[model samples]
Target: MAKALGIGGVFFRARDTAALAAWYEQHLGVPGFWLQEAGLTIFAPFPADTDYFPANRQWMINFRVDDLATLITQLQAADIPVETRPDEWDTPETGRFARITDPEGNPIELWEPPAA
Candidate 1:
């Protein structure tokens, strides 16, 4: 038997595909088929009725980062709104987290795992 190795890509439909793709490339430094650094990738399915993110959206994209604080600053500098509940979102085991949205209203979660 064989199992899935890892996610190779995340494809989605956008109203303005080119502009959306450029936003990701300019702000997140990732274009289609990004070469990410070695790190953990979360595979989770939230409850259909869960309010963890926006109810209107069915899926959310999460990315792992090295420094949440620095990244938050960078994102803020770019005029992107960032939201966080430090007490609720951070933990010794997991790490820090922040939320932001793309031009198309897709939710994105940035997580920085605890230092090893």
Candidate 2:
């Protein structure tokens, strides 16, 4: 059977399109329409009241990062807010993960998967 394998790109409505795009480019180094290395991309929509993600949030974008701690520090140095849970947030099986919110109040999950 034919099926979608991974996400091509994410498109969303923004109040100030140019400014918002610039924010992503400036802070996150996310090149618009940028090509990336090979990996699986998950495209999912949770229930409106789902606790799988933040309730008041519209959506969350998770990016696979190379170094979580360094990236966190870099973002903090830039005065960006980042969330971390030391005790129960991380697991032995999977690698470390951290959370950050974009200027538009969108949740971003920075995940560093366990090394192969």
Candidate 3:
């Protein structure tokens, strides 16, 4: 049987779609039609009561990054708050993880998988 290849796109509602799209491109470098590099894409479903992310939000988007520290610095310089729990989130097996919210309050996960 044929199976789904990969995620084609992510759609969500925003108060100002244009501004939000621009913010993503400006800050995270994600454009409307992004060409992502091939890598591991995690598809896990969390319990309804899980507190991993904001309860109000139904889903969270995770993006793989080349360098987490540099990206975090760039985001911080732009006055965007980034949350990192290195002790709790980072590991040799998994990798480093950081969390940030969009201007419209959407959770975005920045993951730098362990180097091969």
* Top model number, lDDT: 3
TM-score per candidate: 0.95, 0.86, 0.98
Tens-place lDDT per residue, model 1, 1-98, is 99998897898989999999999988877877777898888899989999999999999999888888998999999999999999998999999999
TM-score of 3: 0.98
In candidate 2 the C-alpha lDDT for residue 14 amounts to: 82
Q: Write the per-residue lDDT of candidate 3 for residues 1-116, one digit (tens) a residue.
A: 99999999999999999999999999889999988999999999999999999999999999999999999999999999999999999999999999999999999999999999
Ranking by lDDT: 3, 1, 2
Global CA lDDT computed for model 2: 0.82
Greater TM-score among 1 and 3 belongs to 3
Q: Which 10-residue window of candidate 1 scores lowest in summed lDDT?
A: 26-35
Q: In terms of TM-score, which candidate is stronger, 1 or 2?
A: 1
lDDT by residue (25-70, candidate 2, tens digit) is: 8777788887777764667888898975688888899888788888
Query: Which candidate model has the greater lDDT, 1 or 3?
Result: 3
Question: TM-score of the candidate numbered 2?
Answer: 0.86
**Whole-model lDDT per candidate:** 0.92, 0.82, 0.97
